[model samples]
Target: MTTKRREACPNLEANLEACNCSYEPCGRKGLCCQCVAYHRRAGQLPACFFTEAAEQTYDRSFDRFIQTWS
Candidate 1:
């Protein structure tokens, strides 16, 4: 299992500016490290990997990621 670091994200503003995640209540919205690690542990990709349209589906599976990009 991967460990989560509780350090504050230094580039939060930049990350938020670039993030397209639409999940309103998401705790990992601007925390890229936590978001990536959480998604990786679930065997899926994060919202950033998908298009705006695809991201609305909330399907973060690896297969979905491939289909979205391919």
Candidate 2:
């Protein structure tokens, strides 16, 4: 059996440098679709979840993601 690789979003490459979601051992980096899905399923958000200031705080919890977006 073999698994297929997910397609990479070109936009993610441009934003990886700014993304801070450090919880996952991922390769997608910061693309929205992948990031959102990954986080939503886990009840959390990607490193790009919060602003630079908020991200620096390292509060990647689900509650923090809502508070930041809300």
Best model number under lDDT: 1
Give the per-residue lDDT digits (tens) of candidate 1, residues 3-70. Answer: 23234676776888899999988878778998999999999999999999999999999999899889
How well is each residue in 1-70 modelled by candidate 2, as lDDT tens digits? Answer: 1122223555555566666656455655556677678667877766775877677676668888788888
- How many residue pairs clash in all the candidates, one count each? 0, 2
User: All candidates: CA RMSD in angstroms?
Assistant: 5.4, 5.2
lDDT of each: 0.86, 0.65
Model 1, poorest ten-residue lDDT window? 1-10
- Candidate 2 segments exceeding 4 Å error: 1-7, 51-59, 66-70
Clashing pairs in 1: none
TM-score of each: 0.86, 0.51
Highest TM-score: which candidate? 1
